[model samples]
Target: MKYQGSCHCGQVAYEVDGQLDGAMACNCSICQRKGSLMWFVPRDQLTLLTPESQMATYTFNKHVIQHHFCPTCGIHPFGEGSDPKGNRMAAVNVRCLEGIDLEAVPVKHFDGRAL
Candidate 1:
């Protein structure tokens, strides 16, 4: 299932392939505050309209997840890195997905806010 997504201002756009494995609800303070449901994908599956210069990266606390957002708009479209060591993986925000049936998707809760 390929889906296209864009930032709030439409400055950042991307397309993702494969069915969303599942939605992740992380309990971490940032995740809780952000309230973003996420799914996993390989970095190769995503195509960015802008180069790295067009995005801003944010990191906090454990500094494992590299949160990338559009510089023009603060909307977080997706994130890269799930492991502390920074291997290959991506955490895609479900909210950014288009034409998705959120209710039918499987969801998992992670104690992230607590981590």
Candidate 2:
């Protein structure tokens, strides 16, 4: 399935093709702080609908994930990284997706902090 997402201020937008069935909540420092439920997909499955200049990238710790957020609204709609197998991947913030019923989705908790 395809979904549309954007930052709170609408400065950053994107489209992602994937199923949200495996949405996850990571316990890592950043994910824990943001409280975002993410859906993982291949990098090629995500398309930025807005200009890159409108977003800011953040990295820390292992710095494997490029957390992209809207500087204006400070909303992290999505992030990019490579999987353990070195395959390009993207983490889509399910909260940012349009018409998403977050209450209905079961979130799988990932113990990223332990890694």
Candidate 3:
């Protein structure tokens, strides 16, 4: 399935294709503060609908993931990183997606703080 998402102000928009079996709620510093429910997909499955320059990127800790957000709205819509095997991946914030039953999606908690 394809899902459309964007920052709060729509400055950063994107389209992601994949099945959202569930979302991961990570209990890391940033993840805890932002309260995002993430759906992971291959990087190739995500298409940017707006200019990449319109969004701001932030990284911390191991600095492996590039968390993208809108400077204007300060909303984190997605993040990019590589898996253990080095396959590029995108973590789409399901909370930023359009027209989805968020209540229906099961959520799994991740102890990112322990990493």
TM, every model:
0.86, 0.96, 0.98
CA lDDT, every prediction?
Answer: 0.81, 0.93, 0.96
How much is the lDDT of residue 92 in candidate 2? 93
Off by over 4 Å in 1: 82-86
lDDT of 2: 0.93
lDDT tens digits, residue span 12-108, model 2: 9999988788689999889999999999899999999999998999999878899999999899999999988999999999999999999898999
Writing each residue's lDDT as its tens digit, candidate 1 over 32-102 gives 88788888887788888767677788999867678888889788888988454555777888888878888
How does residue 113 of candidate 1 score in lDDT? 50
Off by over 4 Å in 3: none
Considering TM-score, which of the candidate structures 1 and 2 is the better prediction for this target? 2
Looking at candidate 3, the ten consecutive residues that score lowest on lDDT are 1-10
| lDDT of candidate 3 over 21-96, digit per residue (tens) | 9999999999999999999999999999999999999999889999999999999999999999999999999999
Q: What is the lDDT of residue 37 in candidate 2?
A: 95
Ranking by TM-score: 3, 2, 1
**Of 1 and 3, which scores higher on lDDT?**
3
* lDDT score, candidate 3, position 64: 97
